[model samples]
Target: MSNKTPTLSVTIRTGRGKGAARRARNEGLVPAVVYGHGTDPQHLLLPKLELNTILRNYGLNAVIDLDIEGTSQLVLARQVDVHPLRDYVEHIDFLVIRRGEKVVVDIPVLVEGTPMGGTLTVQEASSVEVEAEAMHIPESIIVDVENAEAGTLVTAGDLNIPSGVTLVTNPEYAIVAVNEAKSAAATEDEIEGDAEGDATEAADE
Candidate 1:
């Protein structure tokens, strides 16, 4: 895993109309808002092409070094709004954070290895609610599923936490479990039924 970070330089924009926003996008910049630490909300323009590349690989918690008109700040990605079908970004919200500050963020849970005999079903895909420092937030939480027997279950409390991190979710939430798969014959029956229905419609046509 690489520990490289992305650096971005932004310029503050005072215009607040649709025309002003369109001009920024035409020039390959994105309209963004920055707010935190009792300061007023600052309208910012970021280089969209570069910021998109960084966010694509790093997810929502990516950190950025932002420069607004020669002023530098360390910030964390907070929220983003994008077009439903277009590739353009509609807006982005960045939270300015200081080092050593305790920031609460959700970390994704990754299951390692298959359950014993490949007979397990993931009851829940993700576990929510966690707290960590602004700079020490983990990329993800790993849950070991190696050789787990039937009737075995893993919960959010079973997660291993690194230093400077804490779990804030319910301790009893089921994250993964072992179960018997539905018989292949049962699946085939459903498929066959659907096929027959399709054929009947074609005949009617």
Candidate 2:
């Protein structure tokens, strides 16, 4: 909701190979790569402690104000390679970014509220792909199904794009839909229970 952008600072590590990464990890640094915008992929190292702290607060999209050996660059998170077995930053990829540059990214959609006593089904026809300015990407889109009736459906074309955001997903794509909850049919056990209740009431008369 806030317009403030998040940033982190890191350093350049020219070392390569498993041993080099292990040493960097031991020294509290993360192995990373900087690529995109037709530039050569630069292998770098980031401060593990500082990056972890920022990610813990800002999530995956945390921007970096990388100070690689005192040269500063603005970048947006692109990919994060992790160790499947442990809590370590195996590698990271950052996309070089400049103001007013449009970048495509997928944003999650959250649906709130349910049709009364009915099953609210999520039929996500498409994930939100938008081309937004590098510095102005939105976090998540909020969709309200609050008290929406059965048979009602919401589609991408129906979505209201936030200011400065452009939709890349197909307009005809379905986002979600509401339907009637399934009703339970009378079973043998239910019939027996009703008979028992009737018999008990009759006997009490």
Identify the candidate with maximal TM-score. 1
TM-scores vs. true structure, each candidate = 0.80, 0.77
Q: lDDT tens string, model 2, 23-141?
A: 99888888888887888888888888888887667666655577777777878889888889996677888999876788887767778775666465766753588888877777777
Reference-based lDDT, residue 22, model 1:
91
What's model 2's lDDT at 61?
Answer: 62
The residue-by-residue lDDT of candidate 1 on 1-205, one tens digit each, is 1245668889998889999999888888999998899888899999988888878777667777787878888788778888889956788999988877878877788888777773756758575678887776788888887778778888888788777688898878888787766578978999999999999999999
The global C-alpha lDDT for each of the candidates, from Candidate 1 onward, is 0.81, 0.78
RMSD values, in order shown? 4.8, 8.3
Q: Residue 20 of candidate 2: its Cα lDDT? A: 98
